[model samples]
Target: MLKVAIVGYGGIAKGPHTSAWKKIENAKVVAACDIRPERLDLAKSAFSSNIGLYEDYKEMIDKEKPDIVDICTPNYLHSPIAVYALEKGAHVICEKPDAISVEDALKMQAAKEASGKVLMTIRNNRYSAGSQYLKHLVTSGQAGEIYSGRCGWIRKRGIPGKGGWFTTKAQSGGGPLIDLGVHMIDLAIYLMGNPKAVSVTGNTYSKFADNTEKADSSHATFGQAKEDGIYDVEDLAMGFVKFDNGSCLQIEFSWASNIKRETRFVQLRGTKKGLEFRDGIIDVFDGGRNTKRARIKHNVDARKLDTGIAKVLNGHEANIRHFVDVITKGVEPVFTIEQGVDMIKILSGIYESAQTGKEVLL
Candidate 1:
């Protein structure tokens, strides 16, 4: 069994990461570290009281000598924690929105290269039943050559941690763009053969920043909101990415908007047929006659879908299994560091576009 040490025993760690490890056969949560003792206590109680817990992550890593280190900290801490874990000679598995900036993401990638250890991010949607089903059709020529796509995650009223690190542009980077956008756009681009994004035109808005006063904060990842926290990030963001393959992707996402309702989906246009996967349902539209009419759908638990930009299986179960398999079974992780680099590039470009008021060239 591979020994694992998890950092940040908060909502994500306790909820999905730990739960997924429980279902895996070759991994064990031997140690966990967090800034708060109460959070560590929660992890101990949730996983096993016998498992070691510490307040300092480096101390835990030094003493436990885990084979794998999982980083579940805030947006700013991801790259730093991941680099330290990699330097400690452990395979690193970090959460989404890789890092605060492309520069840090590049540093993490460099550290992983020097460590000669496996570095994986949680894009578990790639292995989901619905995603896997569609990937089969696209790659097997059933869906044909995928050209362009439009995708988004819209919310009527949703702003995470109204005044915490999530709202601070310095800590959480940007609002829904960095948090929710990463989860949705990455999946769509991955299905498009991971094309090189050449440029991006983007915009961001913060119409609901005043909601911090209401303190009705309910974010899918961070949980309840902090009434008196900083609210400097945008509530909504939209962008169009141009790929080197001549393909384009238009994306829009919001934490709080005056939209009809909250929904997440990706509509891909291919030469042979079209695919739209929304709310765990994959719809294939093949023009007129002589088109394959097979529709692949699954009735997944709806409760989990409401949590951020998740997939049929989310990144929890499938990602944990893939991380373990990469170590034990010598299987390659579908989303590699190169892909992570690509994701960071596009995201950073989006932010630059928003800031400079000009289309950013990647």
Candidate 2:
């Protein structure tokens, strides 16, 4: 059995990790760590009756000596905690936005190389039935030669609670761009066969954050809004990316917007065929007057497919199971550290472009 340690006892830890871990065989949560004592105690009380708990994750890593370390911490701590875990001879599964900066991401990559341990980022979108089928079509030339694509997560009003690490750039890196846009960007690039990014042009806005009344409306789950705390992150971000192969991508993300629908959509246009996944439906359009809609059935329970939270946990379990299978069978995991680093590089370029108001040549 592969022993595991879960670091971070937040909503994700309780909702996704705990739920998904129960489904995996030969894997057990031996310990859990969090900075918050109450959160740690809560995790211990709810998830595992006999699991060890600690305020310092490093302590947990040293004592548990787990085969895998699942990091569900805030964005900024991803690299440090992951590197530390890897250095201590544990495979690492870090939640997405792998690191805040490209340098940190590279450092994590280096650590993985040196440690020779599996390092996987939790990008659950890649595991969706819709995504998997779309990727197969794209790779099989059903999408033909792609020229352009657009992907976005548009929220009418969905800011997370204020005053948390999420709102602080020092803690969460950036705002909606790093938080939500990263997923679509990763999915888009992956479906595009990990294209070489050549340049990026982008913009950011925080107009909605200034209005306190709009904060509650923007947040989908509002635990508590600290009216006195600082909100310095972007509420919205948009970027245009050009690849070395002449393909282009237009991306947008928002915590608050005036859009009519709350859409999480990706549209890909190819020379011979076009594809779109909008509002959970996947459609294919061919140039020869052919159109087909791909029906997606939830292999798992409907309750298991709600938020990214559920998806991430389920995805993490699958990812870790695959990692273990690869390790035991002498193969490589589907998602590698190099791919994770590439994602970080692309996101960093987008943020740089938005800041400079110029096309960042990568």
Candidate 3:
């Protein structure tokens, strides 16, 4: 069995990652490390008292020498921890955005290349039922030439961790563009045939920094909230990305906006048909019949898919399973270190564009 170690024992590590580890037959979490004593204790309880717990990730990695390292830490720590784990000769699976900056992402890529081990960041959205079906259509040429797309994850009132790291620029990068944009943006790019983004133009806003309204999104409870901590990041970000293939994507991400409701969606325009993925449902619209001038629509509901599992698995679990398969079964990885670097470049360009009020070349 592959011995696994987790770097952060927080909500994401404790919840989805933990559930995924349990479902994977060839791997087991033998250790967990966290800076918080309370969180370490919680990890111990969940993994059983026999599991190793440490305050420092380096010490945990050195002592345990685990085969796999799962990183679910804050955005800033992702690159460092992943590099350290990769250098230690362990395959790594990390949470999203890859890293906060291009330099840090390159560092992780170098480590992975040096170690010659798997380094897969979580792109959980691609594992969703709707996404898989859409990918099938795209690869099979049924979706035709996907040239343009729009994607976003907008929340009515869901600034996570309020004045904590989620709102802090230094720790969490540049807010919703990094936090929520990664999800839909990556999905859109993936479905659009993994196009290399060439340029980006963006704008950011931080109007909800001091607002005391209660969060309406369950996502708000992700991290520890502070009464009066730093809130230096943007609450909303809108951007446009142009790819080398001549395709383009329009994106919007907001943690707390005055929208009608919370929604996560991606719409891709293809030559044959247009795909609309909203709130886990996919709708394909064939523009019109040549003779009748009537439109045809096909709706695919992800919730109704027969996944052949004991229970419905979220994208995280499916992604984790894929990671294990890649390591143990020599399965080709859907996510790569180079792709991660490209993703970071796009995000960093958007942030730069937001600041300079000009298009940033990636």
Candidate 4:
């Protein structure tokens, strides 16, 4: 059996990670690490009473020597922890955004290469049935050469874990752009054949947290910032990225916006046909007339959706199952280190553009 340890006992770790691990036969989470004793207690309560818990991940890795490390920490902590785990002779499965910056992502990639260990990011959307179907259709030439696409995830009031790392730029990077947008952007770029980004122009806004007066408290999970907490990140971010293949993508995301409710969209135009994923449903249309349509439904638990993040569905179970395949069968993962680095590069450019008010050249 592949011995596994989970770093950070946060919500995702306790919810999705635990659920996913229970389904895998060859992998077992024997250890957990968290700075918060309360969270460690929660982890023990959810899993086994005999599971090992450590306040520091380094000590945990050094002592337990787990074969796999599941990193479910905040954005900024992802790279350093993952690189350390990889160097300790363990394959790593990291949560999304991979890392906060391109530099860190490259460093993690180099470490993974040096260690000869697998490093996979949890881009759960890729494992979703809708995404799988889209990939099959596009790869099979149903959607020919792509031109441009639009993707966005917006909400009226959905800031989660308010005063925590989620709202802090240093910890969580920007805001919805890095959090929710990363998934949509990844899906867009993936469907578009992972085109290389050449340039990006973007903008960001912070309207909700600053002025709770304008925020819809009715739907708000917006938390109070701790004395040391911060709300420096943007509430919304929008950008246009041009690819080396001459195609362009328009993307946007907002943790809290002026929209009616939560909304999501992804549309692509190709030579032969067009594809779209709107509000969790995938659709295909004839490119010429744009009239003929086919809708594909994914097996999503609609009634059990996480209201805090309604735009995107969680595919944690499927993502972990794929990781199991990679570890047990030595198969290639769906997303590569290069792609993970590329994601950071694009997101970094978008943030730079947002700050400098100039199109950033990738």
Candidate achieving the largest lDDT: 3
- Worst-scoring 10-residue span by lDDT in model 4: 303-312
lDDT score, residue 22, model 3? Answer: 87
Candidate order by TM-score, highest to lowest? 3, 1, 2, 4
Better of 3 and 4 by TM-score: 3
For model 3 the local lDDT of residue 304 reads 48
Give the winner by TM-score.
3
Give each model a TM-score: 0.92, 0.91, 0.94, 0.90
Q: What is the lDDT of residue 99 in candidate 4?
A: 95
lDDT of 1 by residue, 1-362 (tens): 89989999888888889888887778889999999898998888878988989989889999999999998888899999899989999999998889888899999999999999999988866666667766766777877889999888887667765677778888887889888888889889988888989999899988887753332325543743566678888888999999999999999999887766788888899998898888777777878754333334434442243222223355578777777788887875677898888888888899889989999998
**Mind giving the per-residue lDDT tens digits that candidate 2 earns over 31-73?**
9998888888888877667999888999999999999999998
Weakest 10 consecutive residues, lDDT, candidate 2?
Answer: 302-311
User: Which residue ranges in model 3 land beyond 4 Å of their true spot?
Assistant: 289-312
Model 1 spans > 4 angstroms off: 212-224, 289-314
Residue 337 of model 1: what lDDT?
Answer: 92
| lDDT for position 80 in model 4 | 100
- State, as a TM-score between 0 and 1, how close model 4 is to the true structure: 0.90
Report lDDT per candidate: 0.82, 0.79, 0.87, 0.83
> Candidate 2, after superposition: displacement of residue 141 in Å?
2.1
C-alpha lDDT of residue 135 in model 3: 77
- Whichever of 1 and 3 has more TM-score, that candidate is 3
